[model samples]
Target chain A: MPKLDNYRVPLKGPVHLADYDPAATPFAHGTVKAQEKDLKMLNKQLAQLMRPLQGENKRSVLLVLQGMDTSGKDGTVRGVFKTTGPQGLRMATFKSPSKEELSHDYLWRCHAVAPAKGEIGIWNRSHYEDVLVPLVNRWITPQIAKQRYAQINDFERLLAENGTTVLKCMLHISKDEQRVRLQERIDVPEKRWKFSLDDLTVRKQWEAYQQAYEDLLEATSTTHAPWYVVPADNKLHRNLMVNTLLNHCLLDMQPQYPVDYPELVGLQVE
Target chain B: MPKLDNYRVPLKGPVHLADYDPAATPFAHGTVKAQEKDLKMLNKQLAQLMRPLQGENKRSVLLVLQGMDTSGKDGTVRGVFKTTGPQGLRMATFKSPSKEELSHDYLWRCHAVAPAKGEIGIWNRSHYEDVLVPLVNRWITPQIAKQRYAQINDFERLLAENGTTVLKCMLHISKDEQRVRLQERIDVPEKRWKFSLDDLTVRKQWEAYQQAYEDLLEATSTTHAPWYVVPADNKLHRNLMVNTLLNHCLLDMQPQYPVDYPELVGLQVE
Candidate 1:
């Protein structure tokens, strides 16, 4: 319902800490707790719609979730989809391609896990990594990596053409906020296992990754597959935004119930 | 642990409902209260595992859930994995295949959504439907279809060998108990959605399906792929049994803090 295109993050290339504004925007008011409650109700209704789709045996959905570290993607999945009937959902999280996967094309591993008709397939972090991580870490040369970006666009486009409703989300969190979370993990005894120094190394390159993300969103947020930039500084807001976006998608799709079972005629006990 | 082999449903095919004494194992002692408490704890821990795995640029998991219509499969996933970190855990329920999938091998649709590494993949009903459903209904001739029983065994064997950790559970509820639940669904206002008049038609063939399940389990449960018959008559016991089984699996897998992080150096941050 909101302007999906207007939510892009600005880029001055790479900004120093002095250029960072900790208070800027600070996640929009009323998007957090207020939307969360609404999202839960919407999800219950949405579940009913998604349920019979599986039974129809004809169509399915592909939900792609992308976000920064500690952006609460997991929480969103738990809170929003916690009530959906499991019969119609399939989730896949792509990491670095395995030794076997790397032996093939980047999209090969992704192809192996696409959802079937009458199902919902989810990607936690998908082939976008083929662009985002390599660009941020200089793992690939720019010229070839740019080509990879185009390949990704075409790949997602093909999936969409074939009936996969692509819902891509970018969970946007500020650098300082991520630092706050990383430190909290270090400080809390129960959460200590979650901490590692490598987290800080990623934090150091935060601005560059943000720019890369901004660029990725601009290039790939096409009519068929648009990116929804969820203001994720507040975990609650991130979940609400995600729920709102997905609720919108399901409404738009308006998936219907399967035909009643002819096999059940006069079968009920009076 | 409990003798793994002895814990299973007996091999000669399921004994008649009247034969087994419910009072002999009414519920594992304290398993009920422990379930209420353990579910909260399990949900929290699973949430933690899901957070980073969702963001990690590597492996995903596919979880398959299957049970009788009201065998508490949906409720178990909702309660136990309620707080499951959303990023990596995806639920997919299988029904009849599409024209495209029915045109191919039965495994075609299932392979399309198998979980990638490091993610928890859930299946509500998997390819095992070929063995269970078809075998019960005489939908396919027993000669060709009974062969599929062995094929499914090998297919699951391949999955577990490939790190999928295939866990198959049969929610064993008694016939009288199921009738009571079916009646409750019809009589209760809130539970009306859960009842399908069609289910009574299926219930008429329950004894046949039970025999099919028993025969299938006997022929299929291998060392790599074992089946857990969680006494599901009691909902709390079912949840606790599932949690214990899964917790044991994760702890055994020993997913760890990466050893290479330079942060492990002597800062004494804690």
Candidate 2:
């Protein structure tokens, strides 16, 4: 078993997807039932940890999730935060940029929903998608992609300095795993609603997407906000690892609960 | 029984809040249980009506909700949309604008989330707030408010012409009812999370908000997208009225599935 930091993209070198195994479950050390129990405990701890963040009302946290389709971004949200509840957290899903959003810089819409003081703002898919999708499809040049990486780092550093802890995660899943999930979505009556003809189109560009992800993970991994590649071929293990990483970040934040209001320390209310 | 159009703000002349009784249950007849039964039926019908809109994939619907503090915008959404489910509906709640959002023209953020083709988009306190809040708080001049009215009309008309059905409802609740709801938030321990001290400051400006609403309603109620004032003091009646209005809009849309595609008429999947 490796430490959590082992998954963090190295800050000083090139990134290679081959270095990380998508089927590995290095974070979980037990059977499926034992891992589920560990996840239940982690969710409870996270819910409690979020309270002081809300009470202090001065700092915030943002968890960014980026992955290919069927990589379980939505599932991770539901599974990890079932106990943290909605009030303490916000889930912002950045789909294709809208006409008005396109009228501004790429980060305009993302900044508009930055977690206010005292909330855990989670992005199911985030600003990273802007870079990945365009870069993979040849809609943007390598020079432009490089420029975006610098811009993203600066934007994130600004948030970090001004009361936010930005954590980014790339749900790393195997191509074979995605095929099974896509097939289930097509074959199962309940899940068939999600079967889109477009999914197949994107799947054809799998290797290009993997290259794009490797590029972004290398370029944007900064000290202020680093990226983590979570091996997410196993759904349960993905939830456990992501939740554990999130809980670790929250503990590190250690938001304060103000205990200094002395004006009416002993005054009685009528 | 008053017809649906009876509650629509007339397309001409000055408006008066005095004309409507906020506590009246004119839209709901019979027992509480009976109204509950009717709502359940309407929810199912609303669900069925929304599917065709999705299948046609040619048009969309936008439902805008605006009201003063504690006037039940959230409640109406939960009640009316309980059965429409989440698949076809996109609820965009517009809170106080951020610095980035404020930099854009008022309608920029609203337009960014305008429902895609074949979806029912709901705005819980929408761009209408831009007009109402600023006008009441004296953040904008009368001339500017009048200018905004024209701008909003033009914006909405564009959406209508571009295949979006715009339905606006102002959750009309009496000041006394607002006080009751606010008090419950303060008095109940569970709801204390919702008791914002700022709400008291806003409550002090009740009459000003009503005037703002009346002004905007009169100025922007065009034939393309009219404003409906729902008597929202009674929780049940508010749900019934909103559900009925929404159901009516979907029925009027008359979206259909083209079940005769010659390209696939005889195609078979092995």
Candidate 3:
């Protein structure tokens, strides 16, 4: 297995999307059957580890997933969390901002829902959307985007200092792979409703989105809250990699069941 | 099986807490082993039913639980949802109002967190707490409490009008049962942390609190949002009754997998 650090964006340098291979299966080189087995094992460990985290109840987790449409953000959530099954997980998916949301600063909405202590909070799409959408579409000045980056870094730093493990994964998928998935949405009756015309519009701006993602990945990948580019072209491999990263981070935290209460020794129920 | 309607508070007339038998197991008179098996089946059914409700994306469920401390409100949430496992469920637990919360009206905090569309929201305790605590302790005048009841009814009516299925349950535990449970919390080392000294202070006013619950159950039990008093002394029976009511409500709503897209017949994934 490769060092997971091999995927973390460098803190001090510009990033190029071309450097990462979206098709690489460094984390899962096994046959499809073997990969499925491995993913099942990781998922079980994640579910078990959550007991101690919520039992300890002092710290929590925030997983932020940002990716282009048809890039499997929703799929990643279901696949990665299927075994864990929301034991202490709270997922918030940010759609286009409502009128009330737009009236506030972008982070205001994000800050409001930060996981309460002891929860594993998942953001299917998050604040990074602000940086990407506006920057690509020129809705915000570059200077404002830069300011927002610094603000995001500061906010994450506070969460880290106060016991939050922030993990951000940008589901990396090749545009060709996206075309296949987008068409699948259009083709499957059960999935057809998920297809939207706006998705095609977003696909048309693919290069601009790639540039925007590269820019933000460089600007916001701080020491406290790093960005990981997950190779998400293959559905099974994407689930495996995300679950692997999640398991490693949770095990590293090493949350424990609380110590036994000495004062209640030999006490009996009435 | 006994009639589930046996527990529903009548839409008109006063509610007498003493009339309900907290120790009764009308719905689950089977052996403990059999009751556990039934609950497991119900839990699986709840998990299965969540899919079509989420896929429909039009309506949602809001379940409110109110009960005395150690009456198993937390236990009910854990036992009932242990299988559902939070796929699209959102759990919001209301504790004492924080400084910011006190500034707004009582329902403001609750209204903000009411279940989103296609989500089954579980409230460990809810705006109903406002009626119970303040009215029991005389923090609010009788006139104020009466007015708040109307406000609550209107708020719930609005939610029902907007496609939310609201079900409220009051975990009815005898004072003797509560005493045993509270003492166990005090005695068991693993459960010692859950024992709050303030709970005893509240216990001293049990009769008053019961009266408060009775008053609110009468005022707020409407056509749209009805309250059911669960006989909660037997934990298994409590779980069974609550699950039965929930399954019935969900089945009645009858959310179906959407079948709207007609444009993509015979299309194939590239």
Per-candidate TM-score, chain A: 0.84, 0.97, 0.98
Can you give the lDDT of residue B76 in candidate 1?
76
**Displacement of the residue A196 alpha carbon in candidate 2, Å:** 7.5
Provide the global lDDT of candidate 1 against the true structure.
0.66
lDDT of each: 0.66, 0.83, 0.86
Ranking by TM-score: 3, 1, 2
For residues A1-270, what per-residue lDDT tens digits would candidate 1 score against the true structure? Answer: 454444533322422223323333333346545655666676777677676565555666777788777766655666667767344566676756889988999899898788888777778788888888888998887786778868887988898898888778777667667777776766554455556577677777877887777677766776667676677776665665566666667777776554444543343332
lDDT minimum window of 10 residues, candidate 1 chain B: B19-28
Residues B1-270, candidate 2: write the lDDT tens digits. 569999999999999988999998998989999999999898889878877787777899999888888788877877787645355566677889999999999999999989888888889899888888888888899899999999999999999999999999988899888878887766644445455667877888888888888999999889888999999999899999999999999898898854443333332221
TM-score of each: 0.69, 0.66, 0.87
Per-residue C-alpha lDDT of model 3 across residues A72-167, encoded as one tens digit per residue: 887787777765654477778898999999999999999888887778989989988888899889999899989989999999999888899999
Model 3 scores a TM of 0.87
On the 0 to 100 scale, the lDDT of residue A32 in model 2 is: 84
DockQ of candidate 1 relative to the true structure? 0.20
Candidate 3: tens digits of C-alpha lDDT, residues B121-169: 9888999889788888889998999999999999999999999999999
Model 1 CA deviation exceeding 4 Å by range: A1-49, A52-59, A85-87, A136-149, A185-204, A259-265, A268-270, B1-18, B21-25, B28-76, B85-168, B174-208, B215-262, B266-270
Writing each residue's lDDT as its tens digit, candidate 2 over A1-270 gives 568899999998889999999999987868888988998898889877877787777889899999999998867876787555345465577888989999999999999888888878889899898898898889999999999989999999999999889999899999999988887766554454445667777999999999999889999998899899999999888889999988899898887665554432332211
lDDT of 1 by residue, B1-270 (tens): 343344444544543434433223333445556646766776667666654453442444444555666777777776667555344564666767778888999987787767766667777778877677777877777776668867877887777778677667776777777877777766654455456777887888887887776666777666666776766777776766676666666655656533344454444421
Return the lDDT, model 2, position A178. Answer: 91
